[model samples]
Target: MANQTPESNQPSNTQTYGFPIYAADWIPEETVRSKIDKDQDNSEDVGGESSSSTSRSCIVLAGGGGEGRSGIKNVIVICRVDLDTKSLAEQPLGRIVLGTDLPYRMAVHPRGGGLVCALPNSCKRFDWESIISPREGDQGGEEGEEVINELKDVGQQLALAFNQEGSVLAAGGEDGTLRIFEWPCMKTLLDESKAHASVKNLTFSESGKFLVSLGGPLCRVWDVNASAAIASLSKEKDEMFAYCRFSVDNAGNEVLYIAANTERGGSIITWDTTTWKRRRSKLMKNYSISAFNVSADGKLLALGNMEGDVLIIDSTKMKTHQLVKKAHLGLVTALTFSPDSRCLVSVSFDSRAKLTVIEKTPEKRKGSKLAGDVVVVRVAIRGFLLFLDGKGDHRQRK
Candidate 1:
């Protein structure tokens, strides 16, 4: 979808200034509904609607905050959209809100029905709310009981990745500390103390056994289950590693990858996760790399830079597959792929998130085909990204 214009109040049709900075609240309800419906249709149209298919779900990132002062509320939810008949299949189900007062980051538990969010400035832990039945308007309070509250400081700046089964949640912080937690309990399972800097991004291999943490100049690999540090990768140059991903090969082994920003510009590095062995590293010809993602099948890597542009790389062959410019406006912050791996969703400072559906050619279908089944929902948050998920323990009522 394009940026919205002022007079029209409709998303801007033309890409004027690279990243359009508008209020996320400007996205109208009708537009969200339309985007959801368009995403639900299975026909092969780039931007067309088709017959309704099965129910669809999505993980959304709600982020906004400036420095020591909290400009945006600490409210962020990984919303799970339920689709039916080109319309909302059900009210969007999400976790409890983190409140608007905190500077936080969140991640969808690798497994379904769970999530992890953390405060960047403090040593606060995250809690998990058990799965309860969805109520009218997608409310969860009407049904189940509250679970448990756990606390663990995730140091400055945090990012998380879940194991394949979603059983374990791995959190990395700015202090270069990496912690692993078991689901439900939110108990710390493992902590890697050697990392000295804050972690910017991370991900798990498809096998769920290995975890990769991007520490900019330094990269560390861990065995999530064993909670052991397996290997470390770094660059002699003092480039800040901005993003890192663990892409699995056909053998289920972890292949490490990182995008670093340097004085010269930006570059991407790939290594063997198991051995900390270097595979290939390349400096981006243009566009400063901001964030990147690896497809579940381990075939494609999507990279976004400061220019709101995206570069798709073939991991196995180690080559650039496709490069998309103006992928999003403003600073490209985060990226993720659907379980099926056909669609890529990118969020940016432009105050808008974009869903780029890649039409997988026959050669690209290494795994599931989600292109024809992908749908995009326009997420708009007013005031702040409400974190309470509203399903609080009313029983814990004072």
Candidate 2:
């Protein structure tokens, strides 16, 4: 993909840029979706399909924000590209040249007004409005400009999240601590160390009533206001959990889903928020889950794997699971869906981000069921393999 110029109203194709700046080998562990909305000019594709304002999702990338790079350093960039939008997708709307190193972690503010990034021993905030502007501005001088704020120190910060009301910010790091703060102000409210052995993922519930933290072999739930561990979902002293998130439903109840690796393969577990207990744990696939994201509407889930495939799973109906093989040429770093659920944005260690149109899955008539014999056979094979391997979530069948 060719580089895009600094024009927002031009054709969407004319605004996409490829990210070859400060390329690195290891993939970042986080990817976040942006909800900011706007209207833009139209540009018809060669095939006559308009690639204009219908973009529900945009792909953004962060590199060493500035150009010249000595080896690889931690550089944060704010970029947005709509569905069918080009790559590199022009320059990022915002950038931060922090001296932190790789394995970048960032979160888009729930209100879509700001962004927070986490690095080793530090965390910082950036204004989203100015980052997206076509014009560049100085730091802390004007509204929507590059208003960079260094949050209070967070030791070895590994993950960051904003509450649903956008009032609270959470940062989790290597010291097994979870830091909750008032947004913008960055005032520390609760410092809960010993949250885990090492906090790999931290997320707030849709209602901001609960927070979920995932560390290797441990999953703990906490009450937001009380700051106490309310539940522990599932843990294996021998296994490790790589990713976890809250799946919100229409009824406003939230379900906790986590990805873990086993001797058999990679599997997902969903815990009931009401009882703070796991309701289901099932094998999602054989591929190691590297990244996953849920659509805001609570209907869809996207999973990226080590094999570079993105698995689209239906939250309500399990049969709608579809696979996009080799969605990335290398290890996929992050994958996210647009607020409207019509587009998907993915980035990889290949130093590139892509905006892909969502394809409609062919419909299947309701009440259809898998063949009983086929199901039995498949389960028999899997059980035999698990038996040979000596251990698994034995309660599960297929």
Candidate 3:
């Protein structure tokens, strides 16, 4: 794709001048009918299996390009391969067309039924309609119920994060409160004290006993069963402007990690959940920290910055391990580790993502830089690497 340099003063352009624009081209209408007919015939001949299925796995993405900027423009199913692959072997799923009034956020529910989407306005309740439905005598895999109607009063985006295990869902909103919902029945089990600001992120501990909320400068840890704030961590004498993100260890120990940047600059703070003890503080330089991730095993911590540097730290020793400077060309928006902790992945605003396998190295490479560190050693069953990127594309790292 050719990079375009727009005039600095282009009135309607939201991007900066000299920035590379990234958008899928609208298919030409003149060729639509013939392509549809050919695709239909191909599907019928193949017993409903898509041709791309002969090659790679596919995932659908939720984003813009629908009608009026709010309508259901189109759903894109990418036949994605690992970035290193020369070609992908995935198939495309059929697109469900809708008017320009579709929700801003759509989530695939844990129950494997219909999804819950957050629509415009303060509307709550999931507008659920069937999107994919399993057939008789069929085992549920890709086939599942689809969503059609809007469930009113479902709450806003950024306030909720599902556990993806089909058991628990946590939501917080502008009302400065957090609510935990149990699956299948979808009832509000617990509602905690009001937060300091609109809750931006709600995360559950690995064991699902605790919920970490990122809102104001102070990050609050809530007990899931008791439905109360167990601990709140903050910087001394600072206004609550939290860019906080958290993760838990395999033992379900809560670790609240916060990053804030202003005229006074930023620091990455790590707190122990059980005692609410401030374990360690790292002073940052040159760039502001953007996002962070803690490994499932709780040994490694990855903090990404705006300057594209990803500082991999040793959780036990509280020191830096490996530093991938300019890990991504653009702003790093997301970071995630595999279930087994053998690899890591990151997504960026630069319109590209990276999957880096945690190479097993000598013990010298492991502990020499960061004390008592253990590098990822082996692959999981099925030879699949556990790294995951949050950019709508979830693929097994080979």
Model 3 TM-score relative to the real fold: 0.60
Q: For each candidate, what TM-score against the reference?
A: 0.66, 0.71, 0.60
Q: Write the per-residue lDDT of candidate 1 for residues 1-398, one digit (tens) a residue.
A: 12335674322212221222211111112323434444345222753433333445544444444332643433333333333321211222233333332434555544334334455454333322322122254222412322224333334556766676777777677777777788756788886665646776777776777777877466777777777877877675757777777677776766777778777777778776546778777776545777777877878888778778877877777677776778765577666666666666666777555555655556556334554334212233421344444435453573
Best TM-score goes to which candidate?
A: 2
TM value for model 2: 0.71
Candidate 2 vs candidate 3: the TM-score winner is 2
Candidate 1, run of 10 with poorest lDDT: 20-29
* Model 3 C-alpha lDDT per residue in residues 41-123, reported as the tens digit of each score: 56558865333322222222333343454332433222132223322222332333233433344444434433444444332
Ranking by TM-score: 2, 1, 3
If ranked by lDDT, best first, what sequence of candidates would result? 2, 1, 3
